[model samples]
Target: MRLRAITGFFFVIVMLGSVLLGNVVFTLFYLALSVFCLHEFNGLVKQGTADPNLYTGLLNGIFVFLAFAAQSYFPSKFLLFLLPVLLGSIFIQELYKKSEHPFNNIAYCFLGLLFTITPFTFFHGMAFISGSFNFHIPLSFLLMLWANDTGAYVVGSQLGRVKLFPRHSPKKTWEGFIGGILITAGVAVILSRYYTEYDWKQWVSVGILISTFGTMGDLIESMFKRSINVKDSGGILPGHGGLLDRFDGLLLAAPIVYAYLYFITNA
Candidate 1:
């Protein structure tokens, strides 16, 4: 428990510091994080004989993230075109390997990109919403996510009785779920006052989305691990398990929240 708390404290500092610094640091931080997560995902899935092309997949994932980040600086959309080529390279590279399940390898590699890379790419977009570096959106998103996780753990430990999803995650409970939403909503309200980019209602909506879908994302990752019969995604973090275990909620929430913010801002 002490080790987990120590790791979490430093993790929050690094994440928040990157955002506060500027767009470049934020983009680079998540870019590196995306690569590590892709590597971890590929490694974990490989335990089942899917044998994803980690090199090609990492290259593709890095390219995808760079393309997304480039949208902020470059006027021409030329770089985005490279994404398809990068993705295609994965399939092309698979032919040389004598793996029995070539298609399965390709599929898991694609899944690694979709499940890990794409969401972090979307998160990079949040920093440039107003044609400038705005840390509030992404920072607020992280805060609400943390609130939900913390609230769920505290409330669930004390009052949880009924299981939320016994198959994927047995420790989760309906009571904790509700507590998380309520706590996130409260935090969203407070954030709205300072980060006036969005009104209170929109922030609350984001909180709801994070608490709901973020929990789902955690469960989904848990299901992935359960399918493979592994304990943690990796031992990268001292007590947080792995990058994937720590950021699983962000994986699904980032894209959804990005879509919501994009539509509202553009509309």
Candidate 2:
């Protein structure tokens, strides 16, 4: 328990620092995170008897992320051209290898890029919503996520009785899930006062989305681990499993929240 708390404390610091520091740190931090996440995803898929092309997949993922980050500087059509070429390379490279399930490998490689890399790219989009490097969006998103996790754990431990999803994650409870949403909503209320980009209602809505979808994200990763028959994703983070385990919620929630914010602001 002590070890987990210690690891979490430092993890929060690093995450906050990366976002608060500047655009360079934020971009580089998430870029490195996307790479590690792809690495872990490939490792897990390999355990399931599929040999994904790790190098090609990593290169593709990196390129996709860089494409998103550099879209402002480069032509928007550049990614439309670049991604197909990069994805084609995966198939071309697979021909050289002697794997029985060639298409399976290709599918997993694309899955890694879609599941991990794509969502993180949206995080960069969220930061640039104001046409600048404003840290409010990203920072508040993290805070709400943390609040949900903390609230779910605390409330679930004390009052949880019914299971949320016994198959993928038996430890989760409906009580905990509701508790998390409520707590996150409260945090959103506070965030609106300081970060005035959106109203209090909108912030609360973001919190609700993060709590609900973030739980789904966690469960989906648990499903992946269960299918692979692994306890943790990797040993990269002590007491926290791996980078995948740490950021599983962000994996799915980031893109959804970004879309919601984009539509709301534009509408």
Candidate 3:
């Protein structure tokens, strides 16, 4: 457990630094991490009851990385490239041997892509969001997420009684989830005072989304692990299970907050 915390802390530092560096450094780091995570996720599928398709996973990872990078760098070209590539991949994969679960395999492959790579585009988007308020968006999002996770663990351990989803994730409780939200909101309120650019309302909204959707994100990953009959996603992070285990909440929270800000401002 100590080792896990140390390793996780270091990982967090490196990741946060990469984001703070905010340029090609973070982009490359993010891409590499995404590939590693996708590989780890696909490894779980392969190690279990299903026959693992290595090439499929690799291709899917590439496409997901390309899609995200293109979306961040070239929005107009992203869709133009994304649709045709998706159709082509499906068509090519379909032409191969028709297994009993051909579509099932392909679907899972794509689902892995979407779940792993799509949310990360939000981070890329954050790097480019202009305004005096934009500089702190990523840090604020990350800090709120960290607060939520820490609060849930501490509070839930002390006072968690009512189960949130006993079957899906036995340890998660309603009390813990609410505790996480309150703690995260507290942090948000404190930080909002310092942000002279974004209104307090915007920060509060981000806080709410981070805590609420963050909990949902944690549950979603739990559902996936439950479906696969596993405790942790993998043994990569010593005690934390896998990359997905670490980033699950961030994955869900980032996109939601990004979209909220985007639509609110753009619309």
Candidate 4:
């Protein structure tokens, strides 16, 4: 417990610092984040599964992030360039390798990119959600996510009785889920005072979405780990398990939240 707490403290510090610093730090941090996540996914898949195109996938990750990070400067057409290149390189490479399961290789490479890189690209785009670089949206989202996690941990440990999903994650409970949603929405309401662009209701809705999908994200990752017969994604963060463990919530939530915010604001 002591090691976990200590690790968590510094983890929170780095997370806060990266966002509060500026767009550059935020961009650089998440870009590196996306790359590491892809690398980790490749490693996980390679344990007995097919080998993804590590270098090719990494290159795709880097370019994908750079294109999205500079959304204003880079033409959307540049993103189109990546699709054919990714498919062509993977397909062509597999043709020569004479692997036993080339289709699986091709599939997992695509999955790795979709699983990690794509979602993170959506996540970092939150900075520019308001037609400019504003930290409020991303920062607020992070706070809600953290609040849900903390609330769930406390409530589940104290009063959890019903299993949320015993197969994928036995520790989670209905009580924890409800507690997390309530706490996250409450935090969002409080956040409305500072980020006045969105009222309490909108933020609360966003909070609910994050908690709901974030839990799903956790379950999905748990499913992935269970299928692969692993306890944690990696030991990169000590007590935190891995980057995937830390941001699993962001995986499914980012894309949904991004679409939600965009539709509401633009509509």
Q: Each model's TM-score, in the order given? A: 0.98, 0.97, 0.88, 0.96
Report, for every candidate in turn, its global Cα lDDT versus the true structure.
0.92, 0.92, 0.76, 0.88
What lDDT score goes with residue 124 in model 1? 85
Better of 2 and 4 by TM-score: 2
lDDT of each residue in 1-267, candidate 4, tens digit only: 898999999999999988899888899999999899989988998986788778887887788778777784454777767667765787888877868899999899888888898888888888788877788988898999999999999999999999999999999999999999999989998999989978889999999999999999999999998889889999999878988999999999999999999888888
- Over 80-179, each residue of candidate 1 has an lDDT whose tens digit, in order, gives 8877887898889988999888999999999999999999988888878778889998899899999999999999999999999999999999999999
Q: Ranking under TM-score, best-scoring first?
A: 1, 2, 4, 3
The clash tally of candidate 1 reads 0
lDDT of 3 by residue, 136-211 (tens): 7777888889899999999999999999988777999889999998898888888889864467777878888998
In the range 1-267, model 2's lDDT, one tens digit per residue, is 888889988998999998999998899999999999999999989999889988999999899999888863454776767788888999999899998899999999999999899989998889987567789999999999999999999999999999999999999999999999999999999999999999999999999999999999999999999998998999887889988898889989999999999888888
Off by over 4 Å in 2: 72-75
**lDDT score of model 3?**
0.76
Alpha carbon lDDT of residue 42, candidate 2? 98
> Which prediction has the highest TM-score against the true structure?
1
Q: Clashing pairs in model 2?
A: none
